[model samples]
Target: MKAREAVSRVLPATIACLVACAKPQGGGPPRVEIRPSDCAIPSQPLLRGIHSIVAERAMSCAVLDQGQVACWGVQDLGRLGDGFEVKRRDLPTRVPGLQGVVAVTQGNDATFARMADGSVRVWGPNRGGEFGDGSPDYHIAWAPRAVAQWGTIKQIAGGIPTCAIRSDDKVVCAGRARFRRMNEDTAAPGGTPVVVPGLESAAGIAAGSGFTCALLGEGSVWCWGMADAGQLGNGGGEDQDKPVHVRSLDPAVEIDAGSDTACARLAGGGVRCWGRSFAGYGLDHPEKWLRPVEIKGTRDATQISIGDRVGCALLRDSTVACWGESSYDGQLGDGSDETRGTVAGPVACVRDAVQVSVGDNHSCALLRDGTARCWGSGTYGAVGDGTHEIRKIPVAVLDAVEPAPDAERCPPGTTFKRGKGQDDLEAVAEWCETPDGKREGMYVGRWATGQKLQQGGYVSGVRHGEWTRYYEHGEVVSKDRYEHGEPHGVWIAYSLHWRFAFASCFDHGRRVWQVSSEAEANQKRCP
Candidate 1:
């Protein structure tokens, strides 16, 4: 076929499949390559049968086929989650205290895992309250801790702020008060997780350094938080505390949020990106993109990931394409430490990649054979190749695995439990007293762990009057009014920071109206 004719025949399908069918994953022999002197060869064999991979600021975490978790990268602040005793790892190491993990993610200073039970666990620094456990004096979770009572969680993403999506499609986020829960009182330090009000029916969620974007079940996208660089994709340079729809882009199959930028893969296999122009998706401006723009000459994008100043796309043909900001670090995996301009093109020497993840200054691809390869900045061993040297070409990661699954059981160990309590008042430490300070005949109370089992006036063991649920930090996580054992008046939910997540008015146990915040309630004249 003539090259010109071939190009003309597939006008809209910019990607040309070099082979009739992209070869299935995991067939080729490991490519022979020289080892860098800075990296020490691993003593163990590479673990096979990998499943998924994710990266954060300068670390990477992966889930094995048998549901174990492994991680590597800068060891500061417990980013690797290997424990406090071991500070750094140049190759993949099993993250202690995690098992039956279905999904894993990393942030600038933390790591997260979604276990099979739908619960989420967090480790590393709790600065800005990213831990979501609602502890007041805790600074770091050197060991992973269960995130209170969350369950049915499907997806997790980390960044400046961290976020996750529940199986029910509701979005919850912790850390970073910039996207403060609309309004209640003061911005609470992120000591717990709270629902991102106004977001529902979401399929996936991604967090950037300061912003967040969610892909809805119907293929539309919504973004909130910082937009000074047009990262919100709402065609305006205004920060959105609530999700704003990305203009014109729809039927999005997947979405990724990066530092000051975001990208989405459409149903038809085209990819559109908005925000920082360094993504090289071919928008005219080199500074910001206020709306989604197509990367010229790209198609069949099954997945797209964005990083600090780079972006990569995994096409259906098993090959990868990358563009943007490769001048100093060869993160593009294209055999050169040079920029690829505003257009996305193929990366050389990598094929049969089943999945790919991009971090701040590096990139990784998981091949069909269950092996992983990484390239670019190796600072602090972010490359997972046991090296501090930059890799312009793809290099193998130490294949590593964790212990096999035992049986269904609770995660052992309990130094602290943040946001965990029973609904009943069986272990009441103190009962609720009336306004006059008289102990009520029957009332809710606190547990020995300081978690409020129930907090409300009760008569005949039935709830009445004002009620509240307190997180471990002594902040009211939720509150509502009750009358004669029936829900009545206004009800409010707060994030870990004690900011209003949402509020609703109820009458005789029936919800009458709801608002995202106190300001929104005031605007609507909700009494």
Candidate 2:
């Protein structure tokens, strides 16, 4: 990038140092910026496959297809969940102890995950009881741990004193969460998740800077907590300790709350937001709009997410659009740093997205093919491509995978790897080659981050034995047995949280039966 800049006054050694330092570090591939004319989506069948993503200011987290969570960015306050050994990670690192995760939420100082079994896990500071574990408020979590005993939780909303929605559509909050459990004046239970009075049939929840909002089954919205910037949506500057009805909001199917701002995706696929804005969908100005205002051109939004004074929506046609504040630091992913007023526009150079998450200075989109792309500031590795640079356009979250040259890299009758570095040495995948330069014995593939992707065994030059694919967190994706490169025996596929998904029995490369539930697989036998 510096090659195009005017540096005639620089010394030769200094210039060389600048050029050398710009090279990819930590086993990352060479940087290549995608241009608008020929932007192509990169394929990453092994390392990508991110199902959903959640982001805060400098940190971002995504759920892999196997229900494992990978997080990166600033590791401050133990938010990265790998402890304080490193200041930051420029690549996605698995969050230890988290498996079968279906949802994730990031608070200002902590993070939360809801498991497939309807339980919840949390990490980071317990400041204000955000962990919901009933621990000391000053406790700082160095690893993931279970939350307070509660009912089956469907979702978790991150904030000071996080909140959750149970399978019964009842809302309960933990930590410094202040909703009344009994009456309007009764305070919410601290250190445990307490039910929020008057909130039932809740479908989704959003935790804001100092407030919270919920989307009910009937499409109505309710909010509580600090409302100085019209966060309560009641046209008042007063604070609320109990659930309060929000006015003028169209029946919404989804809701998101950010610093002094909140948004909702209407039943008809339109987007409306309220809070700090002089006019239009929303803005960062002091005058707070107490009522929701519709943003034009977002009538096709299927999902809505907002950050500090910024917002983005995943549209029905698999595209993403952004508005509010400026596209500062390229967070809007529109191919430029052009500042905007209230006009909304589509994000360029990426498509087929199922979900989009907006952070303060960056955004990430989970594509339909199970891969992901991120844009804007790469500081703290929020971009997840093993870099710390600003990107105006969308970039792949995974590095490309390729095989090593057999003649030079693979040694006969010995374990072979890509490199001798520390990260490479720990790679779970290694293989051996026959004297004639054909792969033999164990075969496994790993991502650049040194996580096992897939593993299988081979006899001579043909595939044999059991083969298994894994997520970044080491959860099994699929398991199957093969004989002489043909499918044989039982083959099984697991979904989020390692839950039994699909199973099929085969005999000598022939299908016998397939089942969706574990009971059926147990009763049927391949003949």
Candidate 3:
């Protein structure tokens, strides 16, 4: 249940159906007094890859070593598809015509790609069918189709009734109507793609939030639609349209799920999990296991992520371990948000690791030299590290391919120098370009020994007037006022001995109240 709680209020996944879905980005990323009215929408920020990470919910898309794919968080209903929909995009854009690409998934609203000729595409705002193509829409598709004849596919799983695994392994699914009942003798065709009844050879698939699982090549795993928390481990909570065989677990090579929990990866590597949501594996509250358990010291592992609030594993020495619910938001990257003790520890700064995903409260890892690291909640920037702040441990993913190389190149932003300056203290960062780059004026950021940390006044890229944030040693951690990017006047935020930690007032960018003293934000105003 710790997917960062904060649904504030609900009713949307196209009329919610009461629960099988309805959780779109709802309010969970601003602390200190917590005025939250329930924001909803659920996600943001992620970049992976020596090659992979397509985390969904609020948004984040990756897959590049050259196979291009970019995306940032919450781009309104177009969800950062990159065809310009505006509302949010803290950076990372590309997603135009796509190319060679090999994977990506984002479900609950669309964004699926799996090409390299095998073909499969799908774009945003797809109502419930989430582009499984069963014909659900509310406008906003904008572009991105290809889901035709079905064959050559290979593997795809974008939760809530979205599956694909062909090339003869057979397994087709599309959106939901509870997956068209698979078959009890043909009553099909209501939403679209069907065939699951006998789940032919499958071999791999994972989708959650409305159920769907598969692994069989004899390793056995089969699951199907919403079991109300037991996450269909087969022990049962009751909601099935067909497939149900998790009992006693089996050969399993690797598997995953979140939003009701699920984990697997034992052929000897060991690491089991079952749903209804995490709560320390030795168990205390989230009951519903029904079967799959394992998790003690978690063995050799080799990958498993399950996040809606922590459940990592990637061992075999690559290192990574996680338990559950870190007090409130750390999602257990470990640096400190405290809360562990059912055995899986170490996740503090990350290392050799090769891949890990977990999203819905943040977690990302993908290092083996190709670099990537992310920690809990960075909101619309989802910890991609360009800064939206909040990271507890694990940072460093400055656009992963841009912004580093000594910095200096601000088309949209980035500029840091090493030499050639009015006393180049070795820390020179400045942004605010124009001359066709669109932005103009000033945006400083320093720290490589120079220490300015943040300055303000950006133009076309928005952020107007005074802003300041520092702490590399110069103290003063935040004193805001923006007009272009909204949030006008007095925003505060500081606490490392300097005090205040909250003080807000804003105007153009909204916020009308927030206090922790600037004398309680100057006695309060806005009414």
Clashing residue pairs in candidate 1 (N, C-alpha, C atoms within 3 angstroms)? 26-368, 26-369, 47-399, 129-190, 188-497
Report, for every candidate in turn, its global Cα lDDT versus the true structure. Answer: 0.60, 0.61, 0.56
What does each candidate score in C-alpha RMSD? Answer: 19.7, 17.5, 20.1
> Which rank order by TM-score, best down to worst?
2, 1, 3
lDDT of 3 at 350: 65
TM-score of decoy 2: 0.67
Please write out the lDDT profile of model 3 over residues 452-498, one tens digit for every residue. Answer: 22242111111121222322223332323222212345545443244
- Residue 176's lDDT within candidate 1 is 57
TM-score of each: 0.66, 0.67, 0.31
Report the lDDT of model 3 for residue 13: 19
101 Cα displacement, candidate 3 (Å): 33
Clashing pairs in 2: 49-370, 100-497, 129-175
lDDT of 2 by residue, 230-341 (tens): 8888878898887788866657788887777888888876778877762324244436768787776688888778877668888788778777655357776665555433
Evaluation by lDDT, superior candidate among 1 and 2 = 2
lDDT of 3: 0.56
